[model samples]
Target: MKAVLFANTDWYLYNFRRSLAMSLRRQGYDVLLISPPGPYGAKLRALGLRWEPLPMARRSLNPLREAALLWHLVRLLRREQPVLVHGFTIKCAVYGSLAARLAGVPARVNAVAGMGYVFTSSQMKARLLRPVVRGLLRLALGGRGARLILQNADDVALFQQAGLVDPQHIRLIRGSGVNCAQFALATRTRSADDERPRVLLACRLLWDKGLDEFVNAIRQLRLQGCSLHALLAGTPDPGNPATVPEATIRGWVAEGLVTWLGHVDDMAGLLASVDVVVLPSYREGLPRTLVEAAACGLPLITTDVPGCREVVTDDVDGLLVPKGNSEALAHAIRRVLEIPGLAQRLGEAARLKARTQFDEHIVIEHTLEVYAELCDPLAAPAESSP
Candidate 1:
């Protein structure tokens, strides 16, 4: 059997879905990947997976370009003639699903990782395009053999309410799961002589990720005489419109407000040195970093928003601050620092939650089940027409 996975960028496929692809390959499927070429394309090829480069403008709105993209997808799907086609993220999902239907693919899966910029951004452009995008999504996902995978229940509800998808076709599988074994509970602890607590905010450096809010919160904590070490991990995504510019990140690092650790490869090792993990993102499908942090037995502090709240129970496993509120974030950080034993208690609970619910094994098993259903003889039939 052959399966083709489509994504916007090679980097996304390498970083987020590599494990899933490998798992599928191990299950005796000829796994193929289709994405825009990037540095990671070679790396993916090196892993012995077939890689096809397709030009994709992730944020472009030009109708001509979009139409060309759709045509290119239809051509590729026709040539590949794979049994199953899986698309990740919004644009790929919409275009890939439509193209798969046109190519007469047997099965389709659209992973709407998050209601991205069009849904989260307050910008006028995003607002203007929301309805149009919604229409496109409805048309793309309306196929009979298609299944929609959502990372959070909030997104599932939003799509259902918008009449973009039926409840029966929606699957709520939490964020691409974290590797519990890889991020096992830390064995080390801060020595008695070490008075300062270590805090980390690891995510793509994007404006919508609340990086500014996190920096301001750290500044507030420092001004209030709190001596804590703050670490900013992950690199800026230049292709993304919301990316925090390199210059701004440099300025912050130079000012000595936070240590910049760009694109951490060993998150498990890094988590061992930190007392708290924070993601003040404005929104998410489900923040993968928070779930990984939980697996590493670290307490979390995130906004009380859809994706963040799903990973943390307010004051139970971790603290939840108001979205985009630097002051509230600062207060929460201070509370985590000042309250003796609170971090430990929260970390313990978080680790338990990770083991029981958010492990990668669970995600892989569930995803394989979906694939199995699609391959089953009794699976839903394909729509007669596109």
Candidate 2:
């Protein structure tokens, strides 16, 4: 069987899908990674996976441009003729799934990683344009022709309720699973001079990621005499409507509450210096940062939302706070700070959870099972009479 994977960025393919791609290749499937070419594109080629560069625009919302993109993908789908076309993210899922269908591709799988700002935010676009998008999604995902792969149950439920997907074809594959071996537990090494606890926030600098809330929480903690040092990684997405403004992030740096490192190349090295990992994102699809952090033996603090909740069991592996609530975020930070022993215990539990529930191997095996059932629908076990 041949499979073509379509996404926006090379970095996403490297960070999230590389292990799965390698596993697929080992299973003797002709797997190819297609995306906009970049430095990470070179890395994909080096890993011996076929890399095809398509002019995929990641940011534009223009109708004409999107139509052009869809036509281009349809042309590629016709030429490649892969057995299955797997699409990720919002744009790729929308355009790729439609294109694959138009080109008469055998099977189309849409992986809804996270709903993204468009669906999660209460912006005017979300209010006015969301229904239009959902109508398009129904056309793209509904019925027996394709399967919609949801990363979290909350999203799956929403899509089902909205009639965007058929319940029979909706499959839940929790977050892109992490490789526990690669992110094995590491010992925290800090010097006496670096006595301050290191708190790290690793995600896109988006307002909906709760950056404003995080900043306010940090400021509140500082005002209340907490001396934790903080670092913010990840890039500011210029095209995203929810992106945190550069000037605002700079102002925070000016006040010295947190240090901003624009785009990080060495996430593991950065994770090494931190005592705690925090992602107070308004919503998520099993955040990869939390899984990686837990694997590295760092305690977690995340919002009590769907995907985030899957990674950290509240009061067990990590602390959870109300989404978008600064007071709740600040209080959680303070609680983690007051109890040093809790960090170690939670970190241990998080490592175990990553190994047991979020391991890459388990995810790959389950995914392959789904593919097998897709290939041989008759061989798949029938549901018990109900």
Candidate 3:
């Protein structure tokens, strides 16, 4: 059977779900990937996977445009006639599921990675759209063949409380899994001889992501004469209203607060260069940054919110502070860096967690089982072809 996986951006397909698509192909499903046109689209195609660009306006609410986009998807689905349709993120999930229903598709899988901009952002616009999006979620996912995947228990509860999807159809899968083997490093760059501890926060540079808090915490640490270096990875997401301006990032770099390395593709190398990985985001659908850091045997510092909490057990594998509290974040960073042997304990536990829980292979298997529930269960995943 043919499977089509769709997302709002090709970057999401490349960075997050590339493994899933390849795994589906290996299991003898003819896979086709779709997203808005992007540089990463070519990269996906280069991986010997079929990738097509589709027009999707992430923030558009225009009636005619929305109708046209829906028609476009409906037409494509009718033409392609894929048996399985999987969409990532809110907009794509709603749209893909709706189109699948219209086109008479057999199995529809929607992965809402996180609550996304609508539920998380406290801005007036985001708040206004929540009820409407929730309504659409009910319409899209309430169908017989539809399945919803959430990354954490908090989200699962939120959806169930909101009466969105049928509880039976929703599944809790951890964040798109991290490649533990790739991120594994023999030793972190930080050593006793090192002058300063290096901490890295990598994510879309967004205000709600706690970018301001991270900077503020770094400033507070510096004011206390803490000689720790900070590194900011990832790029500002233009699609996100909460995106921080490049000027703001430059200002922080100019102030000697952080070395801004925008969009580092070599994550393993980057992880090796830093002693600690932090994501002070207000919330997450299980931030892969922390998982990758955990896989690298690095201690993580993040907010104690839902998605973040799933990967970290307080004082177990990683440290957690209240969301939006920079002072607490600063103290946590200091505690991890300065307390002798604490970082090692946390890092070792985190590595074990990654290997046992967050490995990509585990996610692939669970996801395929979900697929099996909806489609042909007898279609065994054969030995991976060369």
Which candidate number would show the highest TM-score if scored against the true structure?
A: 3
Write one digit per residue (lDDT tens) for candidate 3, span 149-181: 999999999999999999999998998998899
Would you give me the overall lDDT of model 3?
Answer: 0.91
The regions of model 1 sitting more than 4 angstroms off are 185-195, 378-386
lDDT of 2 by residue, 1-386 (tens): 68888888888898888888999899888998888777898899899998888876677778898888889888988988777788888778888888988998867777888887678889887778787778788888764657878888888888888878789998888878887776674444676797898888999899878888889999999999999998899888875788888899999999998999989876777887888899998888779899999988788999999899989889899999999899998888888878759888888999999888888888888777667656555323343334
lDDT score at residue 368, model 1, on the 0-100 scale: 79
Off by over 4 Å in 3: 185-194, 377-386
Provide the RMSD of all predictions against the true structure, rounded to 1 decimal.
Answer: 3.4, 3.9, 3.5
RMSD of 3: 3.5
Question: How does model 1 score by TM-score?
Answer: 0.94
The CA lDDT of each predicted structure is: 0.88, 0.84, 0.91
Candidate number of the best lDDT: 3
Candidate 3 lDDT for residue 346? 97
**What shift in Å separates residue 360 of candidate 2 from its native position after superposition?**
1.1
Ten consecutive residues with minimal summed lDDT in candidate 2? 377-386
Model 2 TM = 0.94
